[model samples]
Target: MCGGHSRGHFGHHLPMGIPVSVPVEERRSSPVDVLNERLARGEITIEEYQRMRSVLDDQYRTKHSPHIRKPTTA
Candidate 1:
């Protein structure tokens, strides 16, 4: 009974299927646009906007090149 159960479980262990394509929706607003809007509405200070923009820029760059670090020598 144990052997039969093991054989049943091990059958067809390899995955079989064609990959399905999924559509990804693009963001409606760019990071720059979102930051500008927040600044215009007084929701963020100039310093906050600058910081957020820098952070977002770094994030975008890192996303595109995760293995590469930003230059620190200046």
Candidate 2:
């Protein structure tokens, strides 16, 4: 069991033959949104949320910033 829900219970709701099409934006939430939700739910403290948000922001910056170049392998 996961999250107090049985695997079979989850499988029961899924359509076997039908293909489900959900937009990418609808299917996914940003990390910051998830963190905020957790904070609102009292799953994480404000301190934890701020720390994690900082880490996520740093990772995003490192990933998207062109000024930081990856070393080329010969």
Candidate 3:
């Protein structure tokens, strides 16, 4: 008899599962952090920050909040 027979569907080795790889650029800079850094570095003025934040909010709603997106939407 086959004593060391493996179990489960061919590739289902780990019951807890494994992680999928993701791109680096897609995983950087949270909204608040981006705004804060820009503000701190004077890259954006207070008013501009506020305005960008509003747009960013809309972006966060539509997209997955990946830090940047196409400005002109059809």
Candidate 4:
């Protein structure tokens, strides 16, 4: 068991047949979100931001639509 129960592995119960310790709210920011923030901060041009966003959206749809998984390195 994990979470609010016995520490099965690193103080988290195994669910989805995987060992996860971090809470959902503690996860890192998404790439798109980070890029958006940069755009808001005037660190990147809208053209560049939109291009990266399109690429990220494609990868997200391919790999993260049915099942949620960690972000890819590529």
Candidate 5:
């Protein structure tokens, strides 16, 4: 049993058999959060974390800022 539920029942069905619905934000971890977790777990070095974080930040800004246009391929 896990989390007080039988192994077979764990995460399978609710009391009325209704499927669990999670919000989009709750369902997925943000890229930055994942990166931070990786850093905390020693999976990435500080330098790598900084470089990847910068890339993620740039992508977020480019996607959210209307004034910033993406480069077009010829």
Candidate 6:
């Protein structure tokens, strides 16, 4: 049960073909959302955005990967 944690979109209790169980047209923003919004506001350079994006991606994976790919027992 993975410590009874509910990761919403990342929950395994949901059906297949659904990434984390989020509905169509609805995707939660990563921690980089604020930075991304800033980028949209022309507050950051493309290179900086790309660089920060990579870092945030790494962070997201590190935090969520453990619970994301579970080994099923069948």
Give the poorly placed runs of model 6, Cα more than 4 Å off: 1-30, 66-74
Candidate 3: segments with Cα more than 4 A from true spot = 1-27, 63-74
- What stretches of model 5 exceed 4 Å from their correct place? 1-26, 69-74
Candidate 2: tens digits of C-alpha lDDT, residues 1-74: 56677786645566789767778777888899899989999999999999999999878988899698656899
**lDDT, model 4, position 41:** 100
* Ordered list by TM-score, greatest first: 5, 2, 1, 4, 6, 3
lDDT of 6 at 65: 88
Find the candidate with the highest lDDT and give its number: 5
Clashes of each: 0, 0, 0, 2, 0, 2
Q: Which stretches of candidate 4 lie over 4 Å from their true place?
A: 1-27, 65-74
Model 6 clash pairs are: 9-20, 10-20
lDDT values for all models:
0.81, 0.84, 0.76, 0.79, 0.87, 0.76
Determine the C-alpha RMSD for candidate 2 after optimal superposition of all C-alphas. Answer: 12.4
**Which candidate order results from sorting by lDDT in descending order?**
5, 2, 1, 4, 3, 6
Worst 10 residues of 4 by lDDT: 6-15
lDDT of 1 by residue, 1-74 (tens): 46345656643444668444455455477879989999999999999999999999899989999999987997
Clashing pairs for model 3 are none
Give per-model TM-scores.
Answer: 0.51, 0.54, 0.42, 0.49, 0.55, 0.46
- Positional deviation of 34 in candidate 6, in angstroms? 0.5
Better of 2 and 6 by TM-score: 2
Candidates 4 and 5, the one with greater TM-score? 5
Query: Model 2, poorest ten-residue lDDT window?
Result: 6-15
RMSD of 3: 9.9
